[model samples]
Target: MPPLPAFNPSTECPPPGRFPLTWDEIESELVKADDFAESSTRSGLLEELRVHFALVEMATGAVGRLWLAGSFVSGKLDPEDIDVTYLIPSDAYVRAMADPDTVDNLDNLGTKDWCVRQGLRVDAYVLRLAATEDFRALGVTGAMAPDDHKVFESLGVYDEVWQRCRSGPNGIPRGTRRGYVEVVL
Candidate 1:
């Protein structure tokens, strides 16, 4: 891998939507994600969840925390795919979507797009906070398809893995033991 240029944070256009959150706000969400992953891990799922976290951290930038939804988090022992979502700034979303380099890179999110493009089970949505709220409130209204509604309604943040991911003096108690890669901003 080569050293990339510093993120200017000024060269990208925001994606079309509402509820774009700042980087710090997204970190708070990560805490929730850490907890969720911790609570849901069984013998077969922990490594998959950890790998997903590592890949998202390694490949993504300028995004908020990752979300685990669908059958994986809904108590299904064998989920077809690990449905992961990320709350990214609209501008960052636009930049990633347009960049050819980001395509095909799972860590880069090209794999995410490709999975969606092929209608694979690894459901992914890079949405804003407002969009998330709408999904929560509307519960898959008439405007949204039934399958889409199922995915949206499956956002479960409650469970044992709800432990904090942070460590050290400023960290929360019962924090996670699984290793994680911090998302590049």
Candidate 2:
């Protein structure tokens, strides 16, 4: 074979401050999404988005949880965007990404547009089961299904939070005027 191209760090690598997110950070976002999911006025769009990926696992056999993270979960006011991730089994994650149909399903989900309509940034990812574990922990069994529930349980986010977000908050009355149009997920 011909000589391989030499490695180029500058062009190939992310610059300073741009790094793959850590498990600890994901844990923190669990808290943030839980809290944000609690705020009735703020969580309208997010709540609607909770179900867009229901068909994800069925389509790919990727058993995992969905996560919302980043600056929006960091308690920053008017964060540039909201970050979401689908934590799935390692084998399934690879397969899903490689399949065009899976990609198309994600595209049709319109997660990014929904976030933008609410005036927020959107950074989403699909993390493998192993990557979701706390490497620093002494006894890490790796990810489990129902993976999403495990994430919330591991991160100390109560079912009440999930329950509230799922049940739908008592939103503002219609025809009463609103700054942003309600999104349908």
lDDT of 2 at 11: 25
Q: Write one digit per residue (lDDT tens) for candidate 2, span 31-98.
A: 24454445433343343334444555575685565654333333333445445555566668668779
Task: Give stretches of model 2 more than 4 Å off.
Answer: 1-41, 76-81, 107-111, 114-122, 130-185
Clashes of each: 9, 3
Per-residue CA lDDT of model 1 for 112-149, tens digit only, reads 55553544445454543223334444544465433444
Question: In model 1, which range of ten residues has the least summed lDDT?
Answer: 8-17
Error of 2 at 136 (Å): 14
Per-candidate TM-scores read: 0.35, 0.38
Q: After superposition, how far is residue 73 of candidate 1 from its true place, in Å?
A: 2.2
- Candidate 1 residue runs with Cα over 4 Å from true position: 1-41, 106-122, 128-185
